[model samples]
Target chain A: MAVFTRGFGGHHPEADRPLPPGQHLTADFPVLSAGPTPNVDAARWELTVRTESGAEHRWDWAGLQAMPAEDVTVDIHCVTRWSKHDTRWRGVPVDAFFEDVETAADFVVAHSYGGYTTNVPLDDLLDGRAWVAYEYEGDPLEPVHGGPVRLLVPHLYFWKSAKWLRGLTLHEHDEPGFWEQNGYHLYGDPWSEQRYS
Target chain B: MNTWHVAQVVAVGRLTSTARTLTLAVPGFAGAVAGQHVDLRLTAPDGYQAVRSYSLARVGRDEVVELAVDRVDDGEVSTYLVDVAEVGDRMEVRGPLGGFFVWHPDDVGPVQLVAGGSGVVPLAAMVRARATSGSPAPFRLLCSVRSPADAFWADELSAPDGVATTWVYTREAPPGVTRPVGRLSAADVDAHVIPPGERARVFVCGPTGFVESAAALLLDAGHDPARIRTERFGGT
Candidate 1:
């Protein structure tokens, strides 16, 4: 039988924005990762987009910087149940990186420098939905927070925002990444509270 | 497995003024390796629920699971677990989660454990597992806390059982201790932990800042970045 603890009225403060189901507001951003932080120097950093056709689109750090960047302010939610509101970031949109690339694939698996991977739908990366964020709060992102660059997909659970992002491979079929292979939900959607598989 | 299992609080014990241990009877819990954590869910009578991830303090292939919780100021789930929950209380847990941070008994290497405040919980599990499994792996623990009173598992950690343990008190130190009371420094990390030459696999856990600084210190000390794992909790 399911039991509730007595005298355990949950302590959720009223928020201006409605939080996702089962999520609470956290002023402090929690860092959750499987292994050690990978320190990638911006000078040597590169991002690759490989399509199912075996074509590769590559960008060096300077090339990425040459692309137009956008200033974004969005809320990010973690599957661990903490949500931070109004987090600001600056990055080149994923669409900008794909403006000239050709891909009939519908799925993307982001690969990180530390051998971490997370899968997302290609549609989620388009339409100004995601970016390769390099700055947080107007400062160069710290390595612990996935600096020099990390994937930013604010609409999904934060784990989908793979840290120390290095590359993205387009897939004809959806493939589970690190956390997804373990227990996390694939195509994590915060609104639906799809945290676990 | 992602499925939630019903866990009944089978035992409770105070570890410190702000921390406590909860032993839960989880049916079908195959067991977790050292350093794995479980997401605990507590529901209220009104159907309100809160979930928080906690590192396992005890690991084995048994139905019993133990967790240590440190009460964070204004933390709802932590407050309930640390101060309100009792024997016979029930909650939901999904784990044994986390594959990368775990330590298997058969793994060969010296282990370096760095913890800040309540981060010691999971490392303590590793020490216990080492003792129980008769693993000869040399284990070194460097625990940084606010003061002697704030140290969790004080009694067990004070007595060394094959593990070399050192305490760095940030605020106040107990009498007769030579180390100055201050935040952990690279010097402490060098003196207490396994040196980089030994290639010890390091695990660091605690608040974000502590883990970051400690990991930086390890890097500066020439430890391989890939060998050092970290788990940072939200808070100062």
Candidate 2:
């Protein structure tokens, strides 16, 4: 993991002015965030899925990691307008996260906490541009920034990196997430300068 | 003080199909400084959450928190707020964030405000504060925009007789426009900003390149770096 240092500001503070307090934390792939850790017992954590065919299945820790995994490095652009260049991750391969495409009904609707949801085209998922990241910067994930496991879709904007991710459902089309449904662009491509319309 | 409240819109609205202003009105809110931000907390149903920071555009007498937002294509939360959040909507928010960049009326330094694009939000606030504070400090603004239509506060922030406003349009010079056409040169900043020196506090905001280049030009002209405050946002 990256070093989380104390301090802030690139210039001088006003007299009697308190120096801005902050941690210079960088995203170290395969590890987790240096911020506060979330409270969720790995043993009690359960992830379930409802297939596009309307079948429900549940799994626990061992069941998830029991699957195969892969590695990837990608850049992320936050809608707030900051771009985190090239982050690396290792996680369950999409091929393992799915069974038959026919079962998914053609799309993937990701379900996360805080009532946030986003949908991805099954083609996008199958195209091998998506995966579930378990290790960042080469270590176990952290909860504060969605550790243990997170849905990391690098090809899209950083917002697609759903933290504290829980489950995925196969859908037939695209659906918006907490930010997407708002006024954000449907396809976030940084090179396109697609800040908005 | 008020239980340190953070907000996230459970629902959102697309007030503008392109750019958006996320309005988080806090009651008796500990208003933000002229230039500061709040980190947005988004808790997904599946339990994944993210905290992204946004700058406060303006802080009026009202306790409302206005975040000037430009929609990022496919930005999960930003999009959610623009396309979804509503008047009754509630979202997690925190802070009167950021320190290096801020302005208040009581401060005695003569001020020069400069901005490009949406970065005008904070500078606009500072200008407003300076105007109302009764501080005899002579203030000037040199803002750059793409065109007349893209100018955020074209009418209000203009100089006398519409000869020129605090803002300059880089794209098209409207007929009868008085400000310089095209990007403002270092000479323009020097000419408009009175007695460019340490007694003047120059603030530059906008795209990272714009802010950096402008600040560099100011420093090159012998302005003390200490008296200059700036905020750099957005870019590749």
Candidate 3:
């Protein structure tokens, strides 16, 4: 595959800040439970989709593996004002992620472990930059940072791309996440500089 | 936002078994305006690095850039700062960063700081700089901790003289402390923020719930949302 210069998670020749803090905070969080460790049992994993028409469906790991994969390296801007530029990850294709689903609705909410969720407009997920990420830093992802499967949406704030993602729930309305519902901006773009409510 | 200067750790000492203060000196480290912070990035043995932002416990000249960090139970960088980091360690440092939570020498509003747990660091720095600069802004501090044992900077925060301070404890209480015994209530937010009036720029910093909940309480009690600023340590 040909390499691009300005890709997200790609190498930045000039910006010499500290690297991304990696898979997990070197320390654990006392408040939340530990993350799940992925094993060799592919049957244990299931990807679900909730169509905007109220139809729900589930896909097993074997079904997702049959699809194509894409690599992405995008600058990640956190709502907390820290921006990590040029990080790389490889993932399942967006088309493949939605292949079995009835429709790539106009709105989607990513649901994941820890009761974490983030919503985005349906158009952005298929706007040629989204994917179902499975590898990070060119290796099988570790569970702590949402290994095996995750949705990559570089256009919105990082939180909108849920980690340890289990399914996609399409909706007609935009549903905010834990932070967004609590007064954070609706569309969180780094360049737009939307840091707070 | 990407600008930075390499700083050297001139001094590192333990505040407690689980907490330490690392003081770094940048030859011309832009002086912090009280409420600002320094982002310390530490490179681990594996060539990977971690970044953490700590509020300047003290600001101004005469010494190096100093930050007081406690060992959080499950924090990645916090543990390293408390356990493994040492004196004379050189790392890439950035700031006197952050603008919203800044306290310049000229800022003379009736400044009030509401902080919880380690949230005291930035507020402590604000108070320290104010005391040192003699800003005389009618500053008051409402520092809340789990108990006296967990208070990050109990001494500097509640200095009995010119600057009025209140200590709010949510859990256990000691005898004769003369401070509130429970979490900050709407009544507490109203009392501290109302009389201070519109002129006071209320600075709120802490964990997510503490700051968000307290900010809500303050806003509910008639404080302007614009005047009330907040800073959160983690991605709460």
Candidate 4:
């Protein structure tokens, strides 16, 4: 065995900015997942929103692309302590998707194709807070980084932005998802460093 | 449950060109099961901290444990552990986290292991446990790497033993071998791994892409999906 000395020091410019606490700037987007990447087929892909009133709104791949979309650049943070700033994405805003829908539910549980679920306040999905983004940096998002379509809620930890998003189930109560049940914070506000229950 | 513990590096050894093994001595350390991982936390002099989990290479009754870290490109914590941390340096670590991915020596029937790159670390622990307990249970390993130079623990894995091992080279094969350099194919897995009919308990560990493809192949081979346990990591 041989001895060695290594330095673990690196500078993060975001640390000096108004970013969240305990997060470092990462120039490259790192892919992190709890399970295998689910490669979904666009021909069969769909996004549905269900409510307690038995109302359902559904959109297939073509239906989603047919609707007007916009490009937005936002900063995103993950629970794993890496934050990528000025990320460019194009998608339909949740506000537009919610136009025809009416519900009394206070909470929304995002469901993914791979059996992953994350709960968020219904208010978080409206008023320009979230989107169902499918394109990244002017191209289709890669499956390894959650493609076909994924929820984009830049306000909270990236986990809340469910990858491979399939539908949204409205509920009167809050429910924890995969990582949330496994010791992750339910609300996951990055600025406050709310990382655990 | 992610509480931090101070661990002193008792020894350091090179496992391969890009990987190194760190033996950390922690006071009052609880024992870990094979396939469980510990989060190694690195804090800079200015107080910035980063944490990455590494699967334990082995489990024992002693307070010290070993973590084989593969130095990844631009990986903050791994670079420190592999290229800079000294034998006497101390760092923060937590747990023996995760219970689902673990394999006990008393587990019955045969065992099938599939690994990609550093994914071999945890599966190696399971293999070592089987060997140490002198269990007669059949064990097989199918490891995928770029080339002979990239393979870890070549000597120990190649030693004649109760475990059957197969190597898949995607970039360059060892001299005198006929298998063309390529990614793991269905035939490679079928030839190397235990068949689904024998009802072998299958454990697959690796990066997201590799795990996805390998598990798909295993499912296509008619292995019981309920019996296959998979753990995935972000490829570096």
Pick by TM-score: which candidate is best?
Answer: 1
Model 2 chain B worst lDDT run, 10 consecutive residues: B8-17
TM-score of chain B of 1: 0.97
Best by DockQ: 1
Please identify which of the two predictions, 1 or 2, would achieve the higher lDDT against the true structure: 1
lDDT accuracy of residue B17 in candidate 1: 89
| Candidate 3 per-residue lDDT over residues B185-223, each given as its tens digit | 876766555354555788888875677577767766656
**Model 3 chain A poorest ten-residue lDDT run:** A2-11
lDDT of each: 0.89, 0.60, 0.66, 0.83
Q: Give the runs in model 3 whose Cα sits over 4 Å from its true position.
A: A1-153, A156-197, B1-4, B177-180, B194-198
Worst 10 residues of 2 chain A by lDDT: A1-10
**What C-alpha lDDT, on a 0 to 100 scale, does residue A112 get in candidate 1?**
98
Better of 1 and 4 by DockQ: 1
| Model 3 local distance difference test score | 0.66
Show model 4 residue runs off by greater than 4 Å: A1-8, A11-19, B28-31, B60-63, B98-111, B129-139, B158-162, B196-202, B207-209, B212-216, B219-236
lDDT of 2: 0.60
Q: Which model, 2 or 4, shows the larger lDDT?
A: 4
lDDT of 4: 0.83
Fnat scores for every prediction: 0.69, 0.02, 0.01, 0.21
